[model samples]
Target: MSAAAVAEQDGRTGPLERPAGRTCRLCGSNQLRRFLDLGVVPRCELFLTPEAVAAPDVSYPLQVWVCERCLLVQLPPLFTPEETFTDYPYFSSYSTSRVEQARTLVEDAVRRLGLGLDSFVVEVGSNDGYLLQHLVRRWIRCLGIEPSVNVGETAREKGAPTFTEFLTAETGALVRAIHGPADLVIANYVYGDVPDVTDFTRGLRSLVADDGWASIEVQHLLTLVERTEFDTIYHEHFQYFTLLTGQRALATGGLSVVDVELVDIRGGAIRIWARPTECAMEPSVRVTEVLAAEEAAGLHVARGHDGFAEAVSRVRDDLVSFLIEARRAGKKVVGYGASGNGNTLLNYCGVRPDLLAYTVDRNPYKHGRYTPGTRIPVHAPERIAADRPDYVLVLPWNLRAELLDQLSYVREWGGKLVFPIPELEVVSPAPADRPLEHPVF
Candidate 1:
């Protein structure tokens, strides 16, 4: 039986709720082939408290599949949008690197699009007004549509007009009616979280002006499979897109890609510049180049999804062995970055408080809470200095450089860093005599 059929037999909703069989979200194709199954995992962002941990925590199957028709990588809808993002704890402004990326994008958009005081910019899923706040500072008219009430309020406080509502076709029409069509629509890192990809793209088409363009950034599927980025495979991310699948998803909503840029953020990301289908603008050479690269990487076929299960299994076994050896050697191992990806990795590997003593995060909201499923206590960065662990497991390995620089003090005590993903390896601290080697894990 298919995964969806199994889910239905177990009285659960599968990834695609279809009558006949599971269908692709982008293209209504039921030829989905299951690739990797990460077992049941809780929502990555759902951090628990001491009281909540004592109670039952919910979890769902974290399986991934690739559509034969469009080759879109996706997970079944294990949780509703309201369940995942209503009072979300993640804030984009909390990370200096993320904030800088947003500011840089805003500067480029303003210059490239000739955005003036009259230009209206609308950002879908604008968390804490990180990007739109830059526009507000330049005295430009802007609006943010954030579903999370807490993050929306923060955006409002930062002087960016925000609507705490999920962006749907209806919401898009409503925004267009009130603020008129947007000159520039930004959907940074929000595309993957959208459950209904078709409706979200339609909303984008509705909210954007005829001449306006939409900029979307989604983690690349090539990077996910090649780098064995299993930690990013959480219930919150409904679909993983390659340039081919991304173009297919956008085309369903009367949008066409004009340019595509490969970025290093979020491990590996593709920034797509799309315009209305009716627009006569030809796609830039960059778009063709990216599509070619995806084709060469076997992303357009089922082969691209192959070997992923084995890769994830190897990482899991290696990590578990590394942790076991560390504990056996009388070393204290703790984690840094109490992030959603960290939660996924910890829960997948079944690493409990016994294996990973604790973790520290800069986000004040998660300081006193515990990680979902694993129930590892989260403390502030200052706690790291007090404990002085022998090995600090860098959970959010994507931000290794920034985190390494921030926690370099661990080097003073001869503490080393551990990266679980890509491979299990221990990174030695930089010698006091010279600059850090910055070893690539």
Candidate 2:
């Protein structure tokens, strides 16, 4: 289920009190060990308008812990879905790469499963109908179970049938009873924000037909640690999954993992294809291949993340010094994307408006707003062209390919793009002399 759907199911917001001790959300284990301590950080997605800057806001310990029992890297559930998704700012349609990815998934699934007009498909966390819109084009019957009323309405306006609700054990049963079992169930990047893993998996179980498949994509923990992608650890993301641990979580609700694929999206992610236990076949070679890779990386144990805390510190120090030196060099460095990743990176490094000035985003909802904790103002992409800053610190660095063309104009003023994650690298973008077929921003 989407975070909005879960938040809508129970109107009660999560308690703000921090628990003295917490068992791993993936397993009922008391042997969790802390490896990364980012200190108290505000919600990454909670962008504040200029007027809301002075409002009292709550922050939580942005820490990561690995479970000794199951090795699920996770943050304590410090937030309710309501706190994050009710008016969620992340619209999947904003990224062309994301929409294309969704289209590819729908195309492949339709061809593989032979989905037709009689087939019913359900996409949990279907923000703005980015995926279901493709299914609608193919005339396939589908429903988008979105949590955010604001986002889901956009889906409806696009002719994608979207129900603004969260997924739960009861929610799934109700949907199945009313709308019938789904031929395929898809949840893209929704697991990270869900507070209740077992119940939510059960909801997925109830929604799919006995022979139907459920496809879930989650952040690959190995990629996160190896690439130093610590910015993904936010209050809303409750757990990070390894193949072994993800298999365990799925089994909790009678879903068996049959196949898996590693994809380069959202930094890095894994697509797990599962089915009801009774109809599940022998695990695919792909599943074992991924598990072996995780084993080779020693991700099956907590020790695999041993040096990551130091690596995170190094990233922060490197980025902070780079910005300070750039400022000392009398260079202007603004940000490219006003995204959650940028917020986590900025707040962790104690960056303020003085160092960053402001960042620009394609989303108008964030324009005229301040980043949640850092208070860095966000404007439209055109701001860069007007100001002609010397450098652009790419915040949503994962989408560099998609954004580079749109930002190529920055090079007109000898502006370079800076990437801070995996390691900071300053790269001159596309040729300033080259003309764009059309302006994107």
Q: What are the lDDT figures for the candidates, one per model?
A: 0.86, 0.86
Model 1 / residue 51 / CA error / Å: 1.0
Q: Tell me the alpha-carbon RMSD of every candidate.
A: 5.1, 8.5
What is the C-alpha RMSD, rounded to one decimal, of candidate 1?
A: 5.1
lDDT of 2 at 48: 91
For model 2, residues 1-441, the per-residue Cα lDDT tens digits are 865466357552222122357888877787776768888888898889778999966788888777778877778877688777888898999999999999999998999899998999999999999999999999999999999989999999999999888889999999999899999999999977788999999999999999999999999998998999988877878888888988999999999999998988989999999999999999999998999988999788665656677889999998888888878888888998988888889999999988999999999999999998898999998899999998788999888778787788877877788888888777778754332221112
Task: Give all TM-scores, in the order shown.
Answer: 0.92, 0.92
Off by over 4 Å in 1: 1-20, 429-441
| Model 1 TM-score, 2 decimals | 0.92
lDDT value, candidate 1, whole model: 0.86
Per-residue lDDT over 71-134 for candidate 1, one digit per residue giving the tens place of the 0 to 100 score: 8888877668888899999988878888888899999999999999999999999999889889
